[model samples]
Target: MLDWLRVVRMADMEAVRWALVGMSLDTVERAPVGVRAAQLWVSRMLQVGLIDRARPAFRQGSVVWPKDTTSGRVPDLFRQTARHDLAVSAVSARYLARGYEWRRDRRPITRRDHQADGVAILGGQAELVEVELTPKTPIRYKAIHSNHGERLTREGYTRVVYLATPGACRLAMKEADRWLFRDVRPRVVAAPVMDARGAWSGEPDAPWAENLMPPAPPDDAGTPALWEGIA
Candidate 1:
């Protein structure tokens, strides 16, 4: 069932005939060769119990179902599914492991009326996190920083981080060094791109059960620095 489901999902097979037709072929995108190849592959696997033989039902006769048995010589349907699933899991784990308090868009946080794209709780208050692919001009970045800074100060959130892609991050650093070192600057934290391949490349670490938010900023420029939230 799992194997059938996997193939069904990957190839969009609705019925046994479709599954059989999909697995054979000279090329998946073309016909005849594609259909025949699928039929042969499915039939051969069924004969070997690499797939299950379903009980005959009314109208439909007995059908071959792919079974995900852990054998060295087997179709990789289940293994492929598991690999795809694990990649997604690894990315999610990286986010949670980094002390982010994820909330859906428009979800309200107590004490602040502002809803966000996503937020991380800093100092017990939700600070909106904006993940960007492009770098904003210094004026634009400063404006964003100030808005978040003032809001966090007023609402008692310690700071907010703006996790940007590598290119944008470099621009942010440039602006930080040039303009933000003197005056009111929001604590913007940027991290590296978490690609699908890199998601599972890190050490597995458990997330913190609880996190503490720091006290509000005293002045406009007195915001605390940003840190990599991962422990």
Candidate 2:
């Protein structure tokens, strides 16, 4: 919890709920007690001063880093892109539950360009994660893809994951095929961001999890045909 707060810097209760649900499954029904438990812990943290809280820009309350650190307020991270960052944090939490390493995009100030939301290491494969809440024009997408491809090649990332609505995901996959090189193109897979109503809730809609691990074989199965009759 401390690590997640440090990485995300500023996130509210709804985003916390999203993370809890994501860790259990893609549904809101699972792991609800966790959110309440987390809320209690957060309230206690407030008293202890291990973290600080600020009035939200979009959501209700969020904890931030101390004044000395960069990006010290909830409103600061959400001043312009509340929904986007919330989604990214929720996704990052889910990735954390899956034991993936997380790094928020803190591109240097000298380089001002479009940057991905975060990077995640899944099953030893580094992934560049982009959370798209809304679709953009093809010209804009072209530039974004170009940037992503350059980063993928330069930074040793294996795949570019586009998390968006189903339609947007399809567009991402199409653009990936159309734009990125054939060698790395196959690695791109679009996973729709599940339950993104208010807080940008995140859940792995099968394809993303399948990329990391295959399902186990059936239990207590019969012997193979070659050995079945021999016994």
> lDDT per residue, candidate 2, 22-83, as tens digits?
44544334233366676776677777766666665555566343333354433465456655
Deviation from native of the Cα of residue 50 in model 2, angstroms: 3.2
Tens digit per residue, CA lDDT, model 1, 92-161: 2233333333343354455434343354543355555554445678887565554555565466544444
lDDT value, residue 216 of candidate 2: 17
Please report, in order, the local distance difference test score of every candidate based on alpha carbons: 0.41, 0.59
Worst 10 residues of 1 by lDDT: 203-212
Global Cα lDDT for candidate 2: 0.59
Off by over 4 Å in 2: 17-33, 52-78, 106-113, 122-124, 194-208, 212-231
